[model samples]
Target: MDPAAGLTDVRAASPTTGDDLVTLDGVAKTYTTATGTTQALSPTSLAIRRGEFLSVVGPSGCGKSTLLTMISGLVPPTAGEVRIDGELVDRPYRHCGIAFQTSVLLEWRSVLDNVLLQFEMRGIDPAPHRDKAVALLDSLGLEGSSRLYPRELSGGMKQRVSIARALIHDPSLLLMDEPFSAVDALTRDQLSMDLQQVCMDRGRDLTVLFITHHIEEAVFLGDRVLVMTPRPGRIAEVIDIDLPRPRRLEDAGREKQAAYAAHIRETFSRVGVYRRNQHEGGQA
Candidate 1:
């Protein structure tokens, strides 16, 4: 199953769809430093379908984070627009949640309090959401650790807490930036499976935009993987993963998964992004 077959250049692809949860219209970003100005992202356009798991892979400093920030409305684009559910996004949306490479948990707060932080920030009463918070922790395998502080938990446990916090509000979209990159390989694999299960359990209402450097992780987690060029990034290719659902790393489609990863790597090579020093070298 060649994921890249029958697809035109990403810009030439369909720009809008009835199911689109996110639409980027010629969005571009530029940063001005004390020295001068730098273009972090090229003018790029694409649509993310509702409930879709979209993974973005690229070499370091390729504006992958910039793209995510634009979608989250944390930073305004220098040109064009970002729309969520057909509404133009000009500010950070309350319906979106984000997690990053680090757990960023407060050592003083218990896991339960940390999970409830989202509600607190939004001025929502935490008492009514406590049960929901507990369930989220349990769902992420942090049931017994809710009363424990961050310093008392393992790295994986802390990350699970972070995930629980992100979902406590039940956001429409979740943006994860290398969430599993800091964990051990075994822990990373488990986190990936747990995340997949989270998406499945939440059904089609929850969409995810995941950014990682690992090609294998991108293919395994994304419904369609978007590959990007180097600095001043632009879409190089978008590969539709034709693998079956409820995907497990140990599934029988190991060969197919490898092929998908290979296709992404080949695309990266062609775009001059696969050099030795650029590779991150991990399952992620």
Candidate 2:
């Protein structure tokens, strides 16, 4: 199958502006261990505009996840600063929601309860938000499964629950790190649309920073795609995705999307993630 077949979309976004919601001013990270010092991220600066979907892609061992960590304040930058809504990210930023590749759900909690878990962890009453949780689940196409447990759900279903949980509190920013990597191809496509639909429903109030290895997925979903170089990583390029939104999964076949994907693949080749075998006329 074509690699682009796995692509997906969400909502229509306005062009990005100077109105920044998150800013990284010359931010960098380094670590020193018994093995010695290692630089994880370079002194990079970036501004994430409100309500834009930014997809980041890079070869493994690059600082993709580290970037997310610093932005979320899970770890502080060794140099420079990360500010959210103009405040320093000195600790875990409360107004942000994060989801990883795996759907980290409690096996015991019902689906609706799992979503409400966000409110629970924050020490807030989950009562008023229970209906909202149900609504969220419904919006993601799991309408009546609220009473079910994680064990009863498929991989895709569990991820839907995870996303609902993440967005339940209406966070200004959503950080997803390879959130669809585990699902099957067909399921990945479905989840992509579901994710986009949720973003659309929420409007431009939510900013999404999605990290993935799939170039097609990145091009299909992003307002802008960030290409990162190999470790001690720094931004290689940031490509604007100018496609029409509410994009169908089939849009992956279009010339515009394919062109974007091709450009990203070319970036990967130049960065040595993969190389063409000139003699064999194929990729190495």
What stretches of model 2 exceed 4 Å from their correct place? 1-18, 275-284
RMSD of each: 4.2, 5.6
Model 2: lDDT of residue 143: 84
TM-score per model over all chains:
0.93, 0.91
lDDT on C-alpha atoms for all candidate structures: 0.87, 0.86
In terms of TM-score, how similar is model 2 to the real structure? 0.91
User: For residues 1-284, could you state the per-residue lDDT of candidate 1 as single tens digits?
Assistant: 45445434767543566998999989999999999999999888999988989999999989999999999999999998999999999999779888989999988889999989899899988989988889889999887778999999989999999999988898999999989999998898898999999999987889999999988889889998888899989888887888878997875246888888888877887787856553666422
lDDT of 1: 0.87
Among these predictions, the greatest TM-score belongs to 1
